[model samples]
Target: MDASDTIVNEIEKALKQLIVICNKYSLSGSLSTVNDLDNAFPSNLPRSTEVEFLYKNYNPEKLKIETGFTPIKIHSVSELSKAKMVMSAY
Candidate 1:
């Protein structure tokens, strides 16, 4: 169980969540399996490990930055096919 293993699990989890949100909102979007997750991502990458939210105030031209920590995103695979498998009555 190396780092990439954990990251892969997280990526899969995120993909599932994304698919759920898309279904809930009736959004059509999904990347192909190969394109969804690159095998190279598991290795050293240049992407950030956290999300940054920038706040700007027009009152006095002030800016504030907030960072939300998150686990590293190493890999992802499409969940569209899996999610669409669930039958619906409509």
Candidate 2:
């Protein structure tokens, strides 16, 4: 319904995938419940004002000039897993 909702769902999906991989490989970890996260980080406040400002004022060209590295363009949280797969293959 919204960007926040999409991000939350994507994060949960990633956690579930991690759980499956951990179970298969006998690794140790656990997925926190949505309620747990909500309790820890209430939605009433902004998550990170600094990150928000950076996102709003992001400049790829400036970054490239300063760092000499071209950043990969990623539009959403759901695209991260796909991007990771591609990078690993590369």
Candidate 3:
């Protein structure tokens, strides 16, 4: 399913408090707001996968290098623009 569908399903399940999902960025322009809870989040927590995440949003034509991240074009807002799985310290 698409990002929106996944979000809706996950949000419903989130009410159970099984896990905490932190949506870092609204990569897709379609997601205007999340009704479940406040989307405001603190930045720069710390991680190792940042390079991979950055690569996804990286600009091409301007720069290029080996082991480059494949460009993920978001044709539609419903489509998953991007997603990052971050392990937070609880």
Output the number of the lDDT-best candidate. Answer: 2
lDDT of 1 by residue, 1-90 (tens): 777666656766775675576457554333333322344233333333210000010011111122356522222222223323432322
Candidate 2 lands at a TM-score of: 0.36
Per-candidate RMSD vs. true structure? 19.0, 14.7, 17.6
Which candidate gets the maximum TM-score versus the true structure?
2
Q: On residues 14-83, what C-alpha lDDT tens digit does candidate 2 reach at each position?
A: 6466557656765433323222322433234444533232223321111111124763242222233454
Off by over 4 Å in 2: 32-90
TM-score list, all predictions: 0.35, 0.36, 0.18
Which residue pairs in candidate 2 have backbone atoms (N, alpha carbon, C) closer than 3 angstroms, thus clashing? none
Runs with alpha carbons beyond 4 Å of true place in candidate 1: 35-90
CA lDDT of every candidate: 0.33, 0.40, 0.29
- Across residues 1-90, which tens digit of lDDT does each residue of candidate 3 receive? 877666655654642332122123312222132232112221332322322222232212122122356743322111212222222222
